[model samples]
Target chain A: MQDVKAHALLINEVGLHARPSVKLTQLAKRFAATIEIAIAADGPWTDAKSPVKIMRVKAAKGETLYMRANGTDAEEALRALADLVNRKFDEE
Target chain B: MGEQKNVGIVIVSHSAKVAEGAADMVRQMVGDSVPLAAVGGNADGGLGTDVGAIMGAIDKAWSESGVAILVDLGGAETNSEMAVEMMPEERRERIVICNAPLVEGAVMAATEASGGSPLDAVRATAEELMAN
Candidate 1:
C-alpha cells in the first residue's frame, strides 16, 4: 500500500486541546494504518495514535495539521481523520 | 462495544478539589467509557492524603481489565502505595501507581483506556507525559 497524505485545519475553538487530542487519537487507533501528524508539511511528526504525543503538538486554531498514513488502510485512515478535523472534531 | 471494558483510573491528590477536577477533566475528554474515581484530603476534610479514602477510590474505579492510579505529591503516592498494599494479592497485582503528573496523566490514561487499551498501555500513556 502506498502512503496516503492529507491536511485539515484546526478550526475548533480551543484547537487541539485535551478533548480534541483524545478524539483524534481514539479515531486513529481504530485504523490498521500507522498515522503520523505534523504541524507543518515537512517536519517532525508525532504518532497520531498517542494522545500524549498528539496533545504535545499544541496546534492552535487556524493551524493546519498535516497527516500521513502507511498501511493497507492508509487512505481510509487519512480520509476519516481529515473528515473528523473538518467536522471540528464533532465539538461544535 | 457494550460489553467491552476499559482499564480503570483513580486520581489521588492532596486536595479534594484537585482530585475531582482531574477526574472531571478525564470525563470531559474521554467521556464515561472508562471507570474513574477520585480521592483526596484527610478524614477531617483538610489537606492531606488518606489511605482509606484511596482504597475506597480504588474500589470505586475497579475494573476486570485493571486500574492505573495517578497521584500528586509524595504523601499521595505513599498513601496510594499503602492502599495498594492493603488490597488482596490478586487485586494488588492489577493496580499500578503511575509516576506522572496528576491532571495530565489522568486525562491521558483515561483516553488510552477509553480506547480499550490494556492496563500497561494505559499506564504507559500517562507516564509518557512525564517525558514531555
Candidate 2:
C-alpha cells in the first residue's frame, strides 16, 4: 500500500473555521481513499472526512498542515486537498 | 428508479434569532440543496419553543427521506416531542428528535441530509456531537 503525503500552509486569515472546515470535509468525502490531517509536524492525525475533526485541529494562518491519504486514490486525494489549502480555500 | 431521497432538518431554539443563526450556519455548510427550517420563540415572539411553529417548519422541510429535529433546551425538546406526536402518524414515524447542540447539530445533520442520507443516519450523525 503506497500512502501519499502533502504539506501546505493555511493562508486563509480564519484558518479552518466552520465554512472552511465544511469545504475541506466535503472535498475529502469525494475521494475513495482514507485521508487524515495534522496541524503540527508531530501532532496527532485526524480524519479528514469529518468536519468536527478538522475544526478541532485549530489550524491557523501561516501554520503548516500535514495531509496523508491511503487507498486507490491516495495520490489524487492528497494532491487535491493540498491544492485547496495552497489556494487558501479560494478566500480573498 | 427514482432519485435518491434527500432527508430534511428542522432547528428548534428558544430564541428566533438563535434558530435563524443556526439555520444560516447549516446553510453555509450544506448550501441550498438540503431542505431546512428554523423555528423559535412562541406566539408572542419571546423566548421558548412554539409547537405550532415547529410543526409549520416541519411541514416546510418535509420530504420522502424523512426529517430530523434538533432542539436547544429541555422545553424545546418537550415541545418538539409534542409537535412530533401531533404530526400525522405516518409522518411521525419518519421524524426523529435529536438531543444535540443546536448549532453544531444542525450543521452536521444538514450536511448528512445534503448527502442524501436516510433520516436515522442524519439523526445519528447529529446526536454523535453529544459524545464529543
Candidate 3:
C-alpha cells in the first residue's frame, strides 16, 4: 500500500461549499484509495468521499486544505485532489 | 435488473418556501441526477397542503424505482396519504410516505435515490433519520 499527502489552497470565490463539496466527494469516490481532508494543517481529517463531512469542514477561500491518502492508488488520488483544489474546482 | 432506475423523492410541507428550500438543499448535494419535486401550500398560495398539488408533484418525479414522499407535520401526512391513494393503482404501490423531518429526510432520500437505489431502500434511508 502507498501513502501520500499534500496541501492545496482553496482559491474558489465560494470556497468549499455545497456544490463544490459534492464535486470533490464525487471525484474522490472515483479513486481506489482511502482519502481524508482537513481544513487546517493540524485539524482533524474527515472522509473525503462523504459530502456531508466535507461540507462540515467549511474551509473558506484562501484556506489551506490538507489531504491524505492510503491505498494502491494513493498517489493518484492525492495528485488529482490537489489539482482540483488548486484550480478552485474550475469555478469563476 | 441491469439498467436500474433511480428512486424519485417528493418534499411535502405546509409552507411552499419550506418545501422548496429543502428540495434546493437536496439539489445542492445531489445535483440534477436525482428526480425530486416540492409540493406545498394550497392553490391560493396559503399555508396548507393540497392533495392535487402533491399528486402533480409526484407525477413530475415519477420513476420506475418508485417515489418517496416526506411530509412536514400531521395534517400534511394525512393529505399525502390521500394524494397517494388518488394515484393510479399500479403507481400507488411504489409510493411511500416517510415519517421523518422534512429537510433531513429529503436530503437523505435524494442522495440515496441518486445512487439508483430501489424504492424500499430510498424510503428506508429517509425514515432512518428518525433514529438519528
**Among all candidates shown, the one with the greatest TM-score:** 1
Q: Mind giving the per-residue lDDT tens digits that candidate 2 earns over A1-92?
A: 87688899899999987777877887887788999999866659998987666767788888888988899999988889988988878776
Local accuracy by lDDT, each model: 0.91, 0.85, 0.83
Off by over 4 Å in 2: A41-43, B1-4
Per-residue lDDT of model 1, residues B1-132, tens digit only: 441478899999999999999888888888988889999899999999999999999999999888999999999999999999999899999999998899998999998888888899999999998783
lDDT of 1 by residue, A4-92 (tens): 89999989899998788899999998888999999999969899999989988899999999999999999999999999999999999
lDDT, candidate 3, residue A43? Answer: 60
What is the C-alpha lDDT profile of model 3 across B1-132, one tens digit per residue? Answer: 322377888999999999999988988777787788998998899999999999999999988888999999988999999999999999999999987789877876776666566788777767766763
Where does candidate 3 stray beyond 4 Å?
A40-43, A70-76, B1-4, B21-29, B43-45, B81-112, B115-132
Largest DockQ belongs to which candidate? Answer: 1
Which of candidates 2 and 3 is the stronger one according to lDDT? 2
RMSD of 3: 4.0
TM-score of every candidate relative to the true structure = 0.94, 0.87, 0.71
Q: Is the docking of candidate 3 incorrect, acceptable, medium or high quality?
A: incorrect
Ranked candidates, highest TM-score first: 1, 2, 3
Tens digit of per-residue lDDT, candidate 2, span B13-119:
99999999999888877787788899999999899988999999999998888889999989999999999999999999999998788899889887767666678
